[model samples]
Target: MSRHPDLQKFLDRYFMVFLAGYFLSLYAMAGTFSLVWSTYCRDCSREINYPLSLGVLVVTLVTAHAAVVRGRDWGVWMVAALCIGSVVFLLPTYGFRPHMGIFLSIIVVALLALLVLNSKRYRAMRVLLAEYRNKRQVERASKAQRPKVRRSR
Candidate 1:
């Protein structure tokens, strides 16, 4: 099955536009939260602070976007990593709350991560590892095949 040229063009354009907008919103949200709750964050631990949350979100967003743009199949892994990071941060911050909300949020994040991992476009983590390994192997082989030249003064 092939995509219509017009639809493809629209998707290509829309994707970048959507990503840019999404990132911009995240930035705004982070900035707003940081400024508005600066005092609260000051008293809270670093793990629960706005800056750490913002840093993780920005890093994950950029990384996931780059991974998806480079290899569509790798998008899920990026998503999974993001989800995992969210859960880890969340657990520490909210561990005291043995309430329904904390458990539900954790479940949702875990489920979302699982869904991404099992998506049709998903590729196994080993494939990425192998790709890097193969590249290194090729470089090593090429280097070994090259004749070494010695220079004497």
Candidate 2:
């Protein structure tokens, strides 16, 4: 039995859907916010765009999630990088400023991402997915190389 059967099931089924949906929803919300704030938001705001920033954030997080779900060690490190980058990108925007509450929430979200990434279930899912992929590739190669046979009718 696998250590993380549920995680493996989800990975095998709709990992891409979850990743894509989460990213698209985040971007859609950010874009909506930008449109609404364009007139009321007078602060310099660094002339930086919020939609793209959040979109990239979603990309990093989802990429990490996918990497982990697919049993890639590189993605494990990426999750950490995403957490660190989230702090760097969001700190100035939400930290030690007027909006202290927002900063805390962002920190919590980053922490949650790291927590999920490091979960035993997630790690187990990664291993299972790697083995499944290897098995599939091997089967495909063998089928392709198999010799054809025909009998007289």
- Give the Cα error of residue 34 in candidate 2, in Å: 8.5
**On a 0 to 100 scale, what is the lDDT of residue 18 in model 2?**
40
What is candidate 1's local distance difference test score? Answer: 0.52
Shift in Å, residue 47, candidate 1:
14
What TM-score quantifies how close candidate 2 is to the native fold? 0.56
Write out the backbone clash pairs for model 1. Answer: none
Per-residue CA lDDT of model 2 for 38-59, tens digit only, reads 4335353735665565567567
Residue 103 of model 2 has an lDDT of 51
* lDDT to native, each model: 0.52, 0.57
List the lowest-lDDT window of 10 residues for candidate 2.
Answer: 27-36
Q: TM-score per candidate, in order?
A: 0.41, 0.56
Lowest lDDT block of 10, candidate 1: 31-40
Residue pairs with clashing backbones, model 2: none
